[model samples]
Target: NSHRVTYIHNLFQNGAATIAGVSEMFKERKRRGEIPADEEITFIMVTGDGGADIGMGPIVGTANRNDNVILLEYDNEGYMNTGNQLSYATPLGHATSTSHVGPAQVGKQFQHKDTIQIMAGTHIPYLFTGTESQPQDLIKKAAKAQWYAKNYGTVYGKILAACPLNWKNETRDGRNVVDAAVNCNFFPLYEIEQGITTLTYDPEAKGKKVELEDWLKMMGKTKHLLKPENKEIVEAARKEVERRFKRLKAMSEHPDL
Candidate 1:
């Protein structure tokens, strides 16, 4: 029935509704013997961070990750496709359509949701973060996810995406932005296997890590942080980046934890 696949399209109004609809459709097919009783269905949940924010909290607590399911998150740090509006994934002190920085407010006051940590807390069989900047690394992680889901159990992969348009950057500059993010400690490359955490990419070979300012200036979205009056916001962003890096390093050192 590959040629006759059904389609369902909506504004993603409600994640719970989608869950129910998919389950019902699967059941109907099974009841009609379309799928053998012994066979299992592989459910892949591909969602932007927006949909995740709406239903993540409850689903993480309720869903069984140790099954034939994979959650692939294409994280661009905001609702990029939706006119640069702010989403739960938007970083702190960054300007978004919903969280415009001006005299009235200081951009998004809160940092990006630490969904990576939250997923790790689930203690699923596999969890990893991949950046488009590191193509081979991302490919490896994606292959691992597919292998584990088909062989062992479930896996979650959060892949960082770049939005040149939303970020007000040249198309070719997008890769450089991602590179700066990693070098500046804004987005770390790592994976958690079994109960152990490991760092996949490190920029320490260059002696000092790239400055956060370099990353901010790479995209227009974060250019506000470079203003003289916005120095404090820049400092705040640094503090957060350092804090998260420290936590991740600690986790890597203490894998059992």
Candidate 2:
């Protein structure tokens, strides 16, 4: 059997796809033998953090959107499509069009939302993180999303991308910034399958685990935090990265999770 692709606009302007609606469509497809009983159908939704996070309702809807639909997040940290405004995914201490840094104001005051944990909390079958830094790893996750290798539920993946124009970095160095983000543990690579968590990329290799400053200095968006007087904010960002990675490490060790 072969699969088909379709696009639905007005997802927000008209109405977000609900559980009942998606369930019925897949049911009908299978009933018509359009989807083979032995072949798992792959339903994919690629969106941005700012738009997808407007309400948890969509996230909840996605969790129950049959045992298919994989949501891929092209996480650009800020709303790249909207003049680099701050989104929930933008890290703290990073300056954006919406979250500015000045003598009195200090970039974004909040840490990026724990999106992965939120998706994980839904008890979805699979959750993955990939970055432009590692093209091979990203490709593997994309393929895995279609296969449902171990479980039969949602397979979500987040791709950490560096915006050269927004980040005030050279276009040629965009990939390097992605690599730094991974090595700094700011956006580590991993996956959760059937409640079993695994760390796909280990940053423990020699010179692999670098200080968060190394990552921060790569992009001008976060250059404000590197200021001598802004040491406290810099430390806070570093601590957050460390804390997040620690939790991920624990999750990776517990395969029975």
TM-score of every prediction relative to native: 0.84, 0.87
- Candidate 1 local accuracy as lDDT? 0.77
lDDT tens digits, residues 1-257, model 1? 45354434445434434544465577588899987777665556667777677767534743353554567777887876667788878888888889987899888988788787888777777888988889998888877777766676557778778888888889988888888998998889888887688888777755648999999998988888888998988898899999988888888889776
Residues forming the 10-long window of minimal summed lDDT in candidate 2? 11-20
Which 10-residue window of candidate 1 scores lowest in summed lDDT? 7-16
**Clash counts for all predictions:** 0, 0
CA lDDT, every model vs. true structure:
0.77, 0.78
lDDT of 2: 0.78
Candidate 1 residue pairs in backbone clash: none
Off by over 4 Å in 2: 1-5, 11-23, 32-41, 149-151
- On the 0 to 100 scale, the lDDT of residue 46 in model 2 is 66
